[model samples]
Target: MSPQPQAAVGAPLSRVDGRLKVTGQAHYAADHAPEGVVHAVIVDSGVGRGRITGIDTRAALAQPGVLTVISHLNAPKLPYLDNPGGYFNPQGQKLRAFQDDQVHFRGQPVAVVVATTLEVAQHAANLVKVDYDTQQGSTDMTDAPSFELMNYARGDAEAALSSAPVHSDRSYTAARTHHNAMELHAAVAQWNGNQLTIWDKTQWVLGAVAELATVFGITPESVRVLSPFVGGAFGNSLRVWPHTVIAALAAKMTNRPVKLVLTRKQLYTNVGYRPRYEHRVRLGSDRRGRLTAMAHELKAETSRYETYAEAILDLGQMLYATPNVSQSYQSVALDVNTPTPMRGPGYSSAAYAVESALDELAHELGIDPIELRLRNEPQEDPAHNLPFSTRRLRDALRTGAREFGWHRRNPKPRSTRDGDWLIGTGMAVGCYPTHRQPAQARVRLDADGTALVQSATSDMGPGTYTSMTQVAADALGLTMRQVTFQLGDSAMPPAPPQGGSITMASVGSAVQAGCDTLRQQAIKLAVDDERSPLYGADPDKVVVRAGRLSVQGDPGRGETYRRLLTRNKRTNLEVLGGWSPPSGADRFSMYAYSAIFAEVAVDARLGLVRVRRMLGVYDTGRIISPKLADSQALGGMVGGIGMALLEHGEFDNRDGRLVNANLADYLVPVNADIPEIRAIYIDGEDREADPLGVKGLGEVVLVGVAPAIANAVFHATGRRVRDLPITAEALL
Candidate 1:
């Protein structure tokens, strides 16, 4: 076994690209200013659901520098691509901007106005007129049609509820939320004869290439997609949205390179969002505070063209040891755009409801919330009946409680007050299962002793570039400056989507494999060369340190890699490393756990709630880069604060249009909103989980935070607010 180096792996090192980012040199997708680029502005339908009766582009075409206006009337037909197994949805009316006359929702692209300048394109887009045959559309989930329940069950929930000594039931609602990444979505498309190149803001560049290939009826090899820097992407960039396709089509139609950047209003209608959700939870507990039964019912909004469902009850069955658990989830189809996965996705929504309900149960039974959680910790995953790779929920809870001074918390609500504010502290446990995916990478060793690694994963602001480089550096016995990590090009080795908190576990393993292979080759060369000092050393007994090969017992009698390569007249060496999980590994239980603590202050008069401090203790195994891991932990906590008090996407129920489409109307946490946040990782490793023994940490940090804040509110005001964004209005 290789000994873990304490210096590089766990040390707090700043981002390797910090200089590039601060100097305005980091090139994002939109920063690629290609030559001969023309501006394209999409004209959207004003009506929610309608058919185009007439389009008058005569006035728009007469303007100077106005090249063409492509509408459904003049747009060419495209192949209606098939979506396999819900992985990618390419059909379903296909947003064919300038290809179809029917409008399913408001802000549906109807025409493209091409001009020499962006202002001309904007002016021409307004000049193009269209008449619509409008019809009524449903936008409100409360009023939309409901379907039969989708059910999951283990034991008899009703019977267990009937026999329980105590029970409580409550309903909670979460408003829709937009991703609201700082950089808006933009696409630059250029077409040459039979090939197309696109620079777009997307999480999955390969998925975008495949979608564009099918839409254009061309080979996948003919398309190249590049996105190096992303301002932020909760989950909005996971898939290729309609606007990207529209821009590619517009470029082909005009025979000119086209650039399309969505306005803030356009972002609301075009990009993906978290759908509104309503949950009803019923909990039954014994007098001693052990949960006996749980039943959850959930309903969320989806688009009429696509059915979307968030597994909001997934946590209830797995997080606890309840035997009688039952859940039903359904979606109501409305005339709205499809919703995609957001940060924490199903888990966050489920945690808010389940954790809040548990708090209520604790209050009813006169039990501390932490004590109640500790009482129900399970040895195995109850839902899957498989043993966990590693579970530290109890340890996390205990450590967090001690560090948070949880024992000092008053059991009675409104009992602790500080002058004009009600001060309270609360805690909750967070869990996110590990998702495994196969990945590949290429490692190259130059004659100068420097190394280069290539993969197809995007950084998306989690320091994927720096962390992967660090792993390669340690594996290859080289310093950080000697290794260069390359990614964000589809032409590189394939990889899984960067979401799901699985990037490090998947991509880092590939990097390690590649560097390990390169090191082994260097060792073999040293052992085989007659001129080398380590010529007679056993290859198996050899190890690399500081770019040198030597026998395990003698570090002084070693040959440098550069000297060996120069003696052999070798310019460079290369290898490809691939990793896929072994069979039956998926059958076993797996997950990462976290304990979160939050301190909050509530105004007794105005009903205002403010978080004063936060702490998260995580059990993510084998953090590759300590500084980057801490940043991820703190950033996730801030996002949770936004989910709890600021972020909400509002839509006009009358016309099925997003009402709060712009940032000014929609709310998100600013720098002033975040409090003093801190994080601690329980140092450990799970060799059974992966080669690197790392479970993902990106998504789980946001899971339990909202519930902790809501529980703190209950501790402060003696009020149980079930809804999200627990505003002053709700408390009053």
Candidate 2:
């Protein structure tokens, strides 16, 4: 077994790549300038749903510096093969780029103009005229045709609601939101014979390799995707999108290295966004706020050609102690790009409804909000009848409350006023299901006492590079600077996709295992060697610290790794470690939880709300790096503020077109909008969750944030808004 980490894992360390980034030495996807590189600009479909009638590319081809124009009308046929299993979509055909005349969604790539320069390509793309047979399509989640993909029931929820002493029926709607990552979606494709190398912006390099291989009818090994750095992903980069396919296709047709970049408008549709959601929650509780039942009817938007589902209703069934619980999850077809997972996915949308509804019930019963929640806290997962790996929800609540001065909050709405502002405090529970996946890593130790660890994972702004390095440094008994961590390459060790907060728990475990293997190898060699100072020492009693092997309590009698390896004629020591989550029906329900408290000031006459202070206490498993975890927590809260007050992806119902496709129109919280914020984590680990004993943290941080703000707004105004982005229009 590997010894506990001491020097690095738990320490507050800066990112190893921070200097490279600050010095402008980091190369992103678009920064790669391949030899003989050309540019390809995509022509997007203007209609929401249509059939391509005719495409005119002659004008584009005649433009100066225009290399070629490829469209469905003149493009070569691709394999357009179906994925073996769930490489991309488990069900239904994926969107094939420039492979057919049918336009399935708005902003779908219609044509590509390759040119010697980006300006020429842009001008050529504008010149390529496309005619479409427009069709009326559905984009509304509430009224679209729905298919029930999931249904569950434990008892009679309707009867419980009918007989309960207090009941609240409410509906909450969240507008569609886009993942506005700082780095634009881009791909630089280069091919030598059959070997393809791509520098792309993506969350999963292997996923991109697989999808690109399937599209070109090539082996996965022939495609290599590299993404060493990502500005941000949220969740939009989890899968390969159509523009990457177009870049490859254009590169092949033009017989040159091609760089393709999506415009800001194109990103809204080329990649996926958080689907619009309509969640109807009905809750029944006794007069004391103890639960009776809950029924969650969820409707979410998906492309007409694909099915997208999430855990929107799961929290309703398990978040509270309810005897009778039922859930129905429905997918509504829309004439839009396939919906992708955003920051919190379904959990964020569901918590907004469930937690806010609970607040409404509290107001109806004239009970304290926190007291009402405590009255129904479950001893175990009520829906699954299983013990939890670890649940520190009550402690998180109390800690957050005490720190935020919740006990001093004036319970009466509008009672605490600061001149023109009405002060209120509110809190809600946040959670994300604990997730783990199979992963592998390679650790190599050089004779120079430095270590290198590689895994095919992503950082995506959650400080993955920094966190993984910390784990490897401690596991290998080296200082932070002595170890280098590398990731975001398909050729590296296989890892699970970098979404759902799985990288730290999965890849981190694989890294720890790899380092442990290397450490054990060194220890065995040192003890077995006659020249070693600690010869014939008990392998178990020998500990390697700072690359020096010493017997416990006898550091004086030890040998340096440099001496051992030099005497042993070894240049490098390398080991591979793999981590596959245990197989079996889970007997313990696993999740990370948080109790977030917020204080908001609402302008009395103007109806504008501003967050005064926010604090979150988390039941997350042992935090890997306090600094990175703080960044994650703070970023999540900021995103939640956007979801609650400013962000909304409006659509024109008549044309099924996104109204606020650009960032200028879509408002996000600026520095002025955010006030004092803080985070706390309960100290401990979930041994059952993974080898690293960490439950996922990134997603859970965003859950329930919108509802917490909305609930606080209610406390200030004594009015409830069922929809998201509690705007001044709704508040007034």
Candidate 3:
């Protein structure tokens, strides 16, 4: 079959929903207001761990407009049925709100106050007091007991390390960090008997439906979720949280629509955060800096009830061509909410340890960092024993080095300085495994010459709406203005959870398939119709351009979709296109790779570190939307800057309560802190990975970012800080 004409797919188009977002017309979860909707405010426990003793609701009930204060003592028993859970949910019993007296974490919701207005609900929630039997809890992972979750060994790493000529053994710590998306976690639930409708801020609407249905002991089809827009998530809204359950339960109890929006403080604990990690990496290399053996040990924080794990060990096993590699990953049980994937997730956490260790080894061997990485580049994935789908990491490193002027940088730390500032440059390779899940998109071509494409995917600041539309427009041979892409509704065709950087490869492929089907249907219709201009033309040789189906190389022998569909007496043509990871996909190691370079300036007297600039060259296949990809890469660089110099989730060890929960306390890179950031996408495609020839991009951009910045800091100060957020105290 002839391919559809390429028009919109590679264009650097602006987001189709940009106007809606900038005009405040895009309705997020909290913006939704069902008629007669009541407000609910969750009253969370102040103690880290304990059992509820008594609840007092006299003052709260007496307050005007206060409807009800529900707690474990007075709340109805929910079925709390078992759920298999989403991709990100840990394998354990989930926290059931208002149905238990046991408080496992400091911010566990103990009660909820419902009122006519949000302000009234807040007031009542504060007034309704609860007493707890507080017990000391282990919030610190350093002293907490941990159990091994994963252990892998390809060869005798210890023996090889002992025999190697050079070794660098180092421990690294990454502090807890919050997503802190601009939009707070919010849910609005309206229940008509057993049928439930919820407007919630979530990356996966169907995931929320399943969880809510299981919690209420109802069928999954009875729950409907609508989340058209998200301010930003960074993996924060990927799971169904307690507040969503609270909203639905409150609405059921009150027989009115209930809206629950978490405050900024509540967001810090109620939603998931990046778990604190402690990683120790021991590397052994030859005189030429070729890795001989590597050993990795990592322990991350997780709630006592659940075992949350990520891809922390994969990087150690397959990232390079080490002859011997052994890895152990453990999760430390703590009195805190279960952690979830943040931007880059486990890959970013591991990159800091592995890449920083590589940098250390390079320094010890007097070899350039880029040269060391090239020396250790693997011909095949040593862990899986598979060839790479498309490995261009070396090209990315070379391109990035050339673009960033790496040749001019001094090798010696603290060698380049300007007045009171020390200057340094560093680079690190980034990689994230390419992921694709089964996804389906529905496409409809109306007789009016317009198309509507929809999937259950989400746009949590990644421009899903625009990118999918681009795929649809080109596949259907329609102009961008004639095609619309809709998402974030559970009622649409099913799609996998919109995390893991797979949406484009999965959902966009589905969209393209659906549009291609519709376009082919139009061509068949025209060819079969004797009255149509393209009568008796070969369907295989027909191609579409701007809604007109024409014979290949003969533009004049065609008719518009409007003319053909109207003649056929059909109102619209519809098709459901679907895609799944092809069989034998595991035969190849698929990953998106990048080379991130950072330049930093360290103040001599003040010990302040400021990033001067950053450049990221990526080998992520087939840029779907260049503008959005650049935005994603640049944003990732800024986030990496924060991870290196500013962001830290300060937990009070006494109670596991996050002290710096608010934005005022938690330091993110502001505009002033962000310097010029540029992103480059290599010209290539990964046909072995997907039909679209595209590998995932979102997570890859952030994978090696923190390490690049951390390595740069070491170059600037001549001091290697093992801990993240290399603070001023360490520099001083």
Highest lDDT model number: 3
Error of 1 at 728 (Å): 0.9
lDDT of 3 by residue, 1-732 (tens): 888889998999999999988999999999998889899999989899999999999999999999999888877888886545544778888888888799999888999999999999998898988898999988998789999988999889999899999998999999988898899999999999789999999999998888888888899999999999988999988889989998998999999999999999998889888989998999998898989999999999999987888888888788899999999998899999999999988889999899999999999999999999999999999999999999998889889999999999999998999999999898898789999989999999999999999898888999999999899999999999999889999999999888889899999888888888888888888999999989999999999899888988888889999999999999999999999888763879999998999999999898899899999999999999999999899988888888888888887888868899888999998999999899999999998888899999999889888899889988998998889988989999
Candidate 2 residues lying further than 4 Å off, grouped into runs, are 1-5, 83-90
lDDT of 2 by residue, 428-451 (tens): 997888989999999999888888
**Can you give the lDDT of residue 474 in candidate 1?**
84
Better by lDDT, candidate 2 or 1: 2
Ranking, TM-score, top scorer first = 3, 2, 1
Flag the better candidate by lDDT, 2 or 3.
3
> Which pairs clash (backbone N, Cα, C closer than 3 Å) in model 3?
none
Which order, best to worst by lDDT?
3, 2, 1
Better of 1 and 3 by TM-score: 3
| Predicted candidate 1 versus true structure: per-residue lDDT over 1-732, tens digit per residue | 344233456667788888999999998877776788888888988988988999999989998989899888887888855455352352244455455678888988888888988999999999999999999988887777788446789989999998999999899988888888888898989999989999989877888888788888999999998888887888889878777887788789888888988888988888778888898999998999888999998888877776666556778889998989999888888887888888888888888889989989999999999999988888788998988888878878888888877888888998989898998777777788787789999999988888999998888888988998888888888878888899888899988888888788888888888888888888888888999998978787777766777777787878888999999999988999978777763556777888889989999989998999999999888888888988899998998898888888876777877777888888888898889998888878877778989988988988999999988988998998888889999888
- In angstroms, give how far residue 634 of model 1 lies from its true place: 1.0
Error of 3 at 70 (Å): 0.9
